[model samples]
Target: MLYSPFLVTLTLLTLLTASARAQQSGPVVATPQRPPVTEQDRTEAQKFVAEHHPELASLLSQLQKSRPAEFERALRELVPQTQAIQRSKERSPARYESQLAAWKIDSQIRVLMARWSRKQDPETETKVRELIAHRQQLRREQTQAEKQRLTEQLQKIDEQLQNLDQPETQRIQAEWEQLSRRATIAAKQATKQKTNTTGEKKTTAKKSSDQQPAAAQPSPGSR
Candidate 1:
């Protein structure tokens, strides 16, 4: 199985970084100001939206006319993902499809988050949680798939080492060791990040529940 190094590295870095905690936190209510979107960015975003997500294209069109700031923020968020998808398609078609599926889920989650931000209702919050859970499952699937591919690669490398001289064997062993170390670190980091995310989510949920007055709280079946 083929894998894009850039995409792999990007994913690993995201999982390994301290910022991953913030990235995985509760829905951001405020859209942070980004640098102005250039004409080139808008054009590329339009092209990408038209090709991959017609719904987003319609949303973008409406935003452009009614909310220019939102239009820029959406475009800024989209263009990088669009570029990443394009690169994935070029490097690995199977991986591209997987990434695209995740991206679609991400898009849905974003839409739900926006709705929740505007009005913190139970139905929208429930949908957002469902999508987040689905996205996490997809990430697990991707990680498992990558692990299988790496196992196959290691097996091939071992076979090759058996036929090679001592010098070549040493070089292959070094390469294999490096790959093993990286995989080990990535696995550890991912596990830690997931634990933190779950804890944060529980904390956030508790706070949200506590903030609501008991008199105004809906029944369990109401959701």
Candidate 2:
């Protein structure tokens, strides 16, 4: 199967993200049971696939009717990663672009695997391997990028540490103290108000009870 250059790029980006995560977490462990996928998750997954991989959209729909289990599994895989990619787009566009391709590749690979599982064939296996290799290359690139990012961040942190004794530090410290004191005051006021409100409610309730007419006394020979 011919892969679009765009798909190839996206697949690599996803692999890079995965590599970075795996490095941080160390060895992979058994996955814990995931929460049941919701309708909202399915919708989001569908939207994501529709946008990134239009071809897979129909496949997903078909899976839902003919292979419900496979459809759910596909959703479970797609939702969280797609959500993360969406967040990255909002928080960091460059990062989003870097990871987007990788995500696409990963999603495509999953779909392929699902298909292959049902009916294994040499052609499908070859495509899977090719995609996997493409994704790994992306992972390596992503890891390098992550390292570079971390290096830059560390440099910034070091510069900040070196400038710790600057006059701005004192100003910042004073501001922090002022904020903390204000927060303390606000919290105390809130607590006091809540306590007063509760006491007032109790007092009002007691007064209403006191003002109530007493129950009528039983007649002496009513029994």
Candidate 3:
């Protein structure tokens, strides 16, 4: 229930990826395929965590010992750190361009993988597949304008998919919403518990200090 910023970001990214995959229309392929997470990708992630968030390496254990309030505080502290790290990485021109290219290809492959996984309803699935095939075809066009047109078309498709109301789409949306709500609620409860615990500890210490002074006072006769 103690969700760190890194965990939260990773979860959001995964959900967004799934949502992106679901919006496409595609025929079910025999084999599900996705772009492999290359060694370079792994290395980059590890390096980033090691250099920027060494505390994250022990985050799980820390969370276990932390009160809900402390956990929430930690998450709040981590958000800006995580953002700063991402911004720093993105500022590197060479790395930014390379990551951008890799992301686009990975996104396309993930869409295909989602289709193969049957994430879409049959009707929606077919439509997404058609759109994907069309995009692929457009990629072969040898002009910058043509490539730009392809981008426009893809964006239009994405917009349409977002607007499309269907039982399956609603179901997926509801599930994600529920997950987000649960995480929020858990964090709130943890914060409240931690606050109460801290208050009690303070009161107990005060009482103990007051009793100690009284006990140390000499009896009236001895004084």
- Tens digits of per-residue lDDT, candidate 1, 156-220, equal 99988775746877888988999999999999999999999999999999999999987777889
Q: Which ten residues in a row have the lowest lDDT in candidate 3?
A: 8-17
State every prediction's TM-score relative to the real structure.
0.53, 0.54, 0.23
- Which whole-number lDDT from 0 to 100 does residue 208 have in model 2? 100
Clash count, one per candidate: 0, 7, 8
Number of the top candidate by lDDT? 2
Sort the predicted structures by TM-score, highest score first: 2, 1, 3
Better of 1 and 2 by TM-score: 2
In model 2, where is the ten-residue run with the lowest total lDDT?
8-17
For candidate 2, what is the lDDT?
0.74
Residue range 1-223, candidate 2, lDDT tens digits: 4344334333323332344355355676786887777888888878988999876676656556665655566567677778889999999998898799987776677657655655689998999999989988998998999999999999999997866757997869977999999999999999999999999999999999999999999998996
Which lDDT values do the candidates have, in the order given? 0.70, 0.74, 0.52
Candidate 3 structure quality by residue, lDDT tens digits, 1-223: 3454445333323333353345458975574563444545444544544453343434423543544444444343334333444664667754444433333333444433444453447765666566567555544542454577689999999987875655787868988899999999999999999999999999999999887844466779986
TM-score of 1: 0.53
- Segments of candidate 3 deviating more than 4 angstroms: 1-163, 167-176, 179-187, 190-200, 203-211, 216-223
| True lDDT of residue 57, candidate 3 | 31
